[model samples]
Target: MTGEEGLRACDLTLAGLLHLLLRSSHHSSSKLTIFAAQQAPPAPGSRRQRHPRDAKLSTATPSYIYIPTTITKPSATLPSTDDTDTHYRELDLPSFFNQIPSITMDHRPQAWGRPRDDVYGAYNASYMNPNGPNQATQAPIVTGTSVIAIKFKEGVVIAADNLASYGSLARFTDVKRLRKFADSTVVGFGGDVSDMQFLDRHLQSLDIEESYDLSTDQAPRLNAANLHKYLSKLMYKRRSDFDPLWNHLLVAGLDDAGKPFLAAADLLGTTFTSPSLATGFGSALAQPIMRRYVPDDEAAANLTKEKAIEVIKECMKVLFYRDARSLDSYSIAVVTKDGVDLKENEKLEKQSWKFAERIRGYGTQVV
Candidate 1:
């Protein structure tokens, strides 16, 4: 054939093949029929000639009908009412709905966590879980705000307000942040109350061990400097393990040489020592006030006990007035050669908001 005639013949063959494939795919019948390439129609009485590969290709084509995949048949039982009055129980709607069985009905032996209510026993909610591992809380829910401390000629004095805020809500009002480590040492904590409690227990254990160990007198007990070092190491260790204790701690007491020692340590294990130290909002609000009285180590040495107490009280007063997280009630501790004198229930005297009445542009007050 010439080039144009050959091209026309190829086009006709392709069109016929595509038409056959489309019809087989969309038609109602599931069976697919594939035709061998057709030549001009054979002579009327002549037997049709077939390619040698036609029989093999026909055998290779699938004989089974193709059925598209579908979702499984639903087997839901429907409610039926009998027309004939044969023996059949009537449906009790109220009983069917109200008398539903409990999921833990067959669990006997008190279930460890829950008690059998029918036997005069109440469900115990005190236990969290009976059969599984529990998780430790890594988040601080209720937290305290700040702790402030300063050194004087006699020794160191530390103070912290008695307020534990639940997020922004002022929830607890009487939490004492000042903890007496021993007769001489005092530790003030500012951060998560739960974490503070854990550290308090730990310090209590340490104190007990020190008290029992008879060699404490000959060897040296943990002074303020030693305690600060130990705590800094602990904080850094926890931070390295990626589970840091969420707190800022102030260690205050007399050193081995009978000199006052005060230091601060934070969650990241950072430690700083000076005549004065504060944590949380106290670092911002109260530190400046305390620094005014004892600006440096020389000033702290000259500062008397009464003056130090007065300065700390003034700091606490300023915190209550300025810091939103602070409260009037607070705990104060003075560490001296004599011993640690801690008073937890001290309240700020003359703490009042009545001064706002005279402020202009507030309520009905004229500007």
Candidate 2:
């Protein structure tokens, strides 16, 4: 056969195979009949006989069907009214909408599941004020009133009441504000009690670090002066960040040279050293009494430890009478060359209001 006839045969064979494949495939829906070059009819009486399969292939028209590439998913059927009723009955509709909606006209969103105001009281929304500046501690709450201290020849004597007041209320009576650092230093804290706790924990960690260094290098522990500097820097850093620790701290101990050391650091990181130092109401109430004895560095140098303790006790007594936040019970510490002599629970002696009974205008007294 000629090359042209072979090409025509190849085309016809390909079309026939495609038609068979399309017919067998279940996906094909649209049929495309392709008419290839038909074979010439045999001459009359040519004596050529065709096979039955070839005859069938010649008689049948070859076509290509287009099948969609995507498979169609079965459509979902709607539930009958009876089934729908059963489902509705099974659902917990009340639980689904259990939260009480807010009736206020304001656009602010409600805390839906919170207890009603009549039962659990209204929630504090002061912290949620969007217009307020983002800041730490607008003012201190649950505070200590005063910390009083006096310097002497040997060391420093400092005292603070054990009472932590919640505004005007004496909430906690057994909270000691005096913390001893290492063996030599005693720190007296006055101001926010919560901030005091934070500083206390921070100091404890610092003490641990100092202890490790002391063990390794056999170096002397940090003295009162060093600790005071560290605390002042920490306070100043926090203040710079606008998150100052609301505390007035008085550090008392022997200096690095084994001399007496006493200094004060406030929330703003202000530092000052004096023969007599007091914070809060102590600055107004107890300072006069302490300064009467140890007024200057010269007097402090001449003053004995016994004389200092006596003066501190007298100041404490004065504060107990004058300062409303002051308490009869207090914690006092005397830091000297030897170690810290601390008494966490000390009471005023012979404290009484019996004298007021004799006055004419006293309680239940007739004018």
Candidate 3:
């Protein structure tokens, strides 16, 4: 045989060997079918000639032949609804994926912007919610009306009513809004009572820490000016984070120089210092009354402590009558060099609607 015929015979033998190997290892689950090219049979009575390459092809298997096989997974058996005739059902992927979470349909104000419970499961009882930004208070409930404060010759005096109104309803009447920090400072809160309580707790913890750190008598305590600065920074930080404390505060006491210090801070961290300061409705009603006596530092320096207390009490009485949210029962504090003297249960004396009896259209009177 010629050398070309021997080469053709070697190629044909390799193709036949590959085809045989594939057929032997074929899987029943596979859909692939491979066919080897058919070559013409050798001439009648002609002997086939072998090539040296055919020796290698005979003993060695081709490394390139690969047949992909399919894996058959067993079908899951679903529970028979007809056999049980029950409404209960197991959690399934289809239902979990398709059904709307209940949090999405909640119409309550507090549930606003909550994530889909189906995707993240129920929200953990924590300050943070997963997959969403932390929520801050948008509206205040259970709120105090106003806080009034005045700096006098000796020190400062601050006052707030005991009423915590729920919407228009007067809900809690005995909530004291005055907090005495250390001995020289008094803090008065106005606005949301809950936020006020939170701040109160925070201040208490801070006071404990300060006391523990300043064990020596020579170490000066945190004065009203420093405390006011700290609180202002805290409020501003919370405001920057879009989670402000929903309360207006009045910090009253002696400053580092032992002079009376009076300042105010609101939810936005806006602050101002005045001889007489008032928040909420007091800014409109009682402010005018207090400013008449202690309008500036000169007036405050001239005003006596006894006269300052009387003026604050009169303003509270006026607030109780003019401000609907104000209460006849209130708390008052006087901070002097001596210390803070706080009265939490002061009541308006002889305050009533009897004066309206003199008006022609008052009560059942004619117009």
Candidate 4:
């Protein structure tokens, strides 16, 4: 062979061997180089410091990303709900800290000193940027759709597809955002993932004590009416500050007045008390049916919790049957003064047979 031709053949042989080595090592060749944009390391000596202050710092694990960290224990200091509005106004969370003097403790991971925000920004993900990670174009992580819920005789029920798509990708199979607060309230979230997480963290900071009024012997609860108003107000406040919780929400629970409550809140902070409400596709497809039950000022008052829940479930079933982006499995929550009940991992009916029995234009029907 000519000298040039011999060298080219050797180079190809080496490249083939390297490709085989990369495959066996379980590391794709493309992943070998770290992107230059995300190369920050933690500040030196920051890891050895102890905490004299009690600001909470939580770590974000991929699976259980948002675990609660209660700053103040509610064992002895908690108040019962019987106290008048004046009492709640007097119970300042910051004041509780002043009474405790100081809690010179750091509950961070042994290797982590400051908030793990910086630590997670590295190593955990390969191509993340401060602006966002490499997957910025990958669509939202926890997108919310409008959920319409109505109450039933025994309890309330709400449903969302067991789908958390990465944009239109249908990437995550099990992301149930509906949470039951103290077994009494079912909070259905609709919107961007980061905002949802922010709200979750904010709620966790409420000390778990403020959720209920104690004299009532109620579990920490937020009826639809209360939750709706709180979210609307918060969303409005955040928007005013130029940071919005890109979410629409439906809070279903019994209000402080001991009556069923359902309300809608949006990123703009606009809120409306409704017998039924929906966020995304539900607004277009399910809203009409929900409105049938809760249409106008007169019908909503007559609607019962049992009926509302049934209606919501029917809407979910329809969405599953109709909405191409939805799935059969979903989560459901019921809220009342007694507490919240959340159910995840719901399944839709089987449709696998339809594809197998297709009459025409079928897969691999090479005739």
Cα lDDT of all candidates, in order? 0.72, 0.74, 0.74, 0.57
Residue range 1-367, candidate 4, lDDT tens digits: 2212322333444334434544554533222321111112223445221222222323312211111111122324433332211110111222222233233432233333333444344335434446754432124555655566764443445667667667667776776778665455666787776677778777666527664355466554554556667778898998787767788777777766666666778888988765567778888899899887767546766667667766777788777756766777788777655667677886654344454445565576654
Best-first order by TM-score: 3, 1, 2, 4
What is the lDDT, from 0 to 100, of the residue 125 in candidate 1?
67
Model 1 backbone overlap count: 0
Model 1 worst lDDT window (10 residues): 62-71
Query: Roughly what TM-score does model 2 have, to 2 decimal places?
Result: 0.62
Q: Which stretches of candidate 4 lie over 4 Å from their true place?
A: 1-142, 152-156, 211-224, 296-307, 349-367
What clash pairs does model 2 have? none
lDDT of 1 by residue, 1-367 (tens): 2222222333444434433544554533323332222223223453322222222222221111111111122313322232211111112223222233454432432353354476645666655667764334378888999899999998998999999999988999989888887688899999989888988999999988888875645866877888889999998998898888889999999887989999999999999998999999888988888888889999999999999999899889989988888888999999899998899989888667777687788788676
172 Cα displacement, candidate 4 (Å):
0.9
Give lDDT tens digits, candidate 3, residues 1-367: 3323323534445445433543554533223332111222233454342232222222212212222111222313422223221111111222222333344543323455666566567877665547765346778878999999998899998999899999999989999999999887999998888789899999999999988989898987899999999999999999999889999999999888999999999999999999999999999998999989977799989999899999998898888877888889999998989998999998898677776688798677887
CA displacement after TM-score superposition, residue 102 of candidate 4 (Å): 53
Per-residue CA lDDT of model 2 for 1-367, tens digit only, reads 2222322333444435433444554423323322222233334564321222222122321221111111122314323323111110111123212222453432212454565565667778897789997547658879998999999988899999999999999999999999999988999999999889999999999889988888665687799999999999999999999899999999999887998999999999999999999999999988988889888899999999898888888888888877889899999999988898999999988676776688898898898
Which candidate number maximizes TM-score? 3
What candidate 3 gets wrong by more than 4 Å, as runs, is 1-135, 352-361
All models, RMSD in angstroms = 20.6, 24.1, 20.0, 28.7
